[model samples]
Structure formats: structure tokens, C-alpha cells
Target: MDGPRTLVVSGASRGIGRHVAMRAQAAGWRVIGLARQTDAGAPFEMRACDVADSAAVRETFRALRGEPRLHGLVNAAGIASMNLLLATPPETMRRLVEVNLLGTMYCCAEMGRLLARRRGGRIVNFSTIAVALGLRGEAAYVAAKSGVEGFSRAFAREMADFAVTVNTIAPGPVETDLIRHVPKGQIDAIVARQVVPRMAEAEDVWQLVAFLLGDAAAMMSGQVLHVGGA
Candidate 1:
């Protein structure tokens, strides 16, 4: 059977989300990319909005309601902050939660409603391997990602009877701007910790996301798929 014909990917200006959007477009799906900035190089329709703002997300979805069929949603808009539990400021922590967790909730809530009306769709939420591995300076990030895992599972259960599959992808050490601040030695140490002895590439994570949004992943839902060399 043919898979979904349309896909909506957030954070598509760069990194894994960009890769996913490009790959999905290449595979003949109509792609709509949501990001805070517009990149002239982007190959799909770029919608500028901060997913952290509930009103903006709702307005974007409302504008997209005219489309005949919306099949997939990738919640990839995220913000990363690294700080010790004692050193992290209250506002910083709140910002991380707002962007990584609340933003995801807003996107999922809005998109899930549309998918529910159609009786079928897929949602791929982004989590982090830090949530599982427990890094030293990622207290806020870990907490937010952990929340994302729980949220994805619960939402998946709620959407199951409607044939909407919601899943989370917990990726480890991908080479993106998110890691630009890490020391070279620290980067090497992280790669060594992985069984593959290398960091994941943007495309590496995108492949799994593509699978989840594709027909082959119809049976999978409410699960967190970890993408790491180990």
C-alpha cells in the first residue's frame, strides 16, 4: 500500500529535521517545514513560527487545515542547554522546558487533533539519549526529554484507537550545532562511549524518523526508539 502523501516537520531549518524534510520530499511526499527562520536553501514550504508559542502553533495548523490529507508530523523543534544542577538558573531551566517539552506538547496537541479527525497519521517526537545515559551537565535537558518520552507514550495510547501512532526517538551524540560548544576531548570521549566508536550523523537519525513516518512503521507506537552506536 502507498504510504502517507504529506508530512509536516518542525525544526526543519537545519540538522536532523532538515535531513528528514529533504529525504521525505525526495521520496515524493509533500513536505511542510516549520522553523523559526526561513532558509532559502530549503526545498519545501517553510513556515516560520516558534513552536513554543501555543497561539502561533495553533494558527499555523489552522492555516494548514485546508490541505486534503495530513499524514505525518515530526516534532523536532528543540533547545539544548548544558549546565550543572546547582549552577543552572531557574529561568534557563524554564526556557528549556518551554522549548523542548511545552513546544512539543503544543505541536502534538494541535496536529493530533487534525490527525484524529482523519482517523490516521503518525507523530515522531524527539527525545535525547541524555535522558537515558544521564550526563553530568544536562539536568534540565534530561528532565525535559524524559517528559517528552512520557508524553509520547501517553499520547500514543490515547490516539491508538484512532489509528494515530505516536512515538519518540532518543538520539545520542549527533553532529549538529547542538554539540558545537562541546570540547574536542569531550566529543571524543562521547564517541568512544558508543559501541560504534563514532558520533551519529544527521542522516543517521533521519533514517529512523523516516521509517517511523512510513508505512512500514504502522504497527509501532508508544515506544521510544534509541539511535546510538550501542
Candidate 2:
């Protein structure tokens, strides 16, 4: 009898991460959620963690490594900021780089190690359309997402030897709490740039996640998929 496939998703407390967790569970995967909330209230396993903190990520994955079978990972933990380069505060810059770049790196490092042993697994990461559009007032966010894209491409090749695929999904803009902070005018500008010209729903993003997690995507690696028709 085959047991349930396992997947780890960071930032699982809310936003895209939470939505992914729900979708994965519905797809019959055992989802392990990692977030900062101790009581992240969910059916699947929840590990309280701050992915930005390297030590915490290391520890969380260390425990997860002991699982009987690990099949997938989603590095969805990230932060967004909107400010001109001149106006962007140093603290915000540090946080953007820390939570977005460093967090993804740390999760990828630990999860990649475990998934490699499986000889077959999937790793999906989140990027943003800003990285491609060079959107104004998002210098810090764009820089961090650029790092994620680069890391995903390079790491895909490195992990291929182990039959593990790594890919990134860059959503134009979704109706998540993450978007509430942005100015409405700026949001409208981004929407106008998309071919779809509409807010991305949770399912819109999950469609790609499901495909990437499916066996059909075995040959798809090192790709950066743009959503919302960007």
C-alpha cells in the first residue's frame, strides 16, 4: 500500500502559502506547513518557524528529514515592499532581502537535501512579475525576487542529477493580504500591464503548482512560469 505523498510549504499561515497547502491537501498530499504561528490551525502538520531565521529553518527541516518519504516542497515564504530606491528605508531593504531571498535560500537548501535522497521530487518557488516588468516603487522586492529566479534556475541543474525538478512561478498580482499594503493606483498600473488585467485567484496560481507537482512535469525544470498572462 502506498502512503500519502508529503509536501512542505513555508509561510503556510496565510496568503499564497496557505492556499497552496489547502490545494495540496485536496490533491491527496500530506502537507507540512511551516510558519511563525504556533497554532497555525490546519488539518495538516504545522511547524512553527521563521523561514528568515536560518537556524529555525535548519532545525525544522532536520526534523522533517526523518519522515518516511518526502516528495515535494514549496518555497512560498516571501515579503513584498513598494518604495522608490531613494525612499526605501534601510530596514525595509534588509527585510525584503532577508525574508524573500534568504528565506527561500534556506528552505531550498534544507528541502533540496532531503528531496535529493528520494531520487524524484518537486520544488516550486514563488517569484513576482515585478522582476520582469521592472515596476517602479518596488526596488527591494524586485531585487530579492531576481535572486530567487536565479537560484531556481541554477539549482534546477544541480538537482537534476538526483531527478529532482526545481521551477518558479511569478504571479502578476493576487488578491491576498500581501496586496493590501500597496497603493491602489500602483496596483491598477500593474493590472493594466497584464494581458489578463485581473486579479489572480488562489486557484489561478494553484493550477501551475498542481502541474509542477504532477508526474507530467517530470521533464519540466529550471522554468520560470509567468501567471496572470503577464
Best by TM-score: 2
Tens digit of per-residue lDDT, candidate 1, span 66-86: 678688999988888877989
lDDT of 2 by residue, 39-111 (tens): 5368778989898999999999999877776889998888887779899889999999999989998998998
Query: Which pairs in model 1 have colliding backbones?
Result: none
The numbered model that scores best in lDDT is 2
lDDT: worst 10-residue window of model 1: 189-198
The lDDT, on a scale of 0 to 1, for candidate 1 is: 0.88
Instruction: List runs of model 1 lying over 4 Å from the truth.
Output: 1-4
lDDT for 107 in candidate 1 is 95
Residue-level lDDT for 185 in candidate 1:
84
Error of 2 at 175 (Å): 0.2
RMSD of each: 1.8, 1.1
**Relative to the unseen true structure, what is the C-alpha lDDT of residue 119 in candidate 2, on a scale of 0 to 100?**
84
Overall lDDT per candidate, in order of appearance: 0.88, 0.90
